[model samples]
Target: MNWDRIEGNWKQMTGSVKEQWGDLTDDEIQQAEGNREKLAGKIQERYGIEKDEAERQIDAFAAKH
Candidate 1:
């Protein structure tokens, strides 16, 4: 799936994001608001992972969706 589709459907996607990154709070995901960079940042903060790893995880998630 394209990032554009993900962004366009952000509200619907939140549940999947929560399932994938359980550490992230709903508030954090809402704050991200479909921005890839912001979502990556939240994932990094919640998972204690590096930026690259966060982005990689996001890529995998996007691909799955």
Candidate 2:
């Protein structure tokens, strides 16, 4: 989904997001503010993944129902 849709639904989606990125604290997700770029950055920072991989993982997750 696009950033607008993601941001709109962030409150509900954050729970799933937190589950996906177990290492990220709630505060970090809050700081991301539903921006996909920030979320990808945080995922890479917290998980030590490459930027491309982090984006891919997030895109994949976002595709899920």
Q: Which pairs of residues have clashing backbones in candidate 2?
A: none
TM-score per candidate = 0.97, 0.90
Task: List model 1 lDDT by residue over 1-65, tens digit each.
Answer: 99999999999999999999998999999999999999999988888999999999999999999
Cα RMSD of all models vs. native, in order, equals: 0.5, 1.2
Summing lDDT over every window of 10 consecutive residues in candidate 1, give the lowest-scoring window: 40-49
How good is model 2 by TM-score? 0.90
Worst window of 10 by summed lDDT in candidate 2:
1-10
Each candidate's lDDT (Cα)? 0.95, 0.88
Residue 24, candidate 2: C-alpha displacement in angstroms = 0.6
Candidate 2's residue-wise lDDT over 1-65, tens digit each? 76578788988789988988889999999999889999999999999999999999888888872
lDDT of 1: 0.95
The deviation in Å at residue 59 for candidate 1 is 0.4
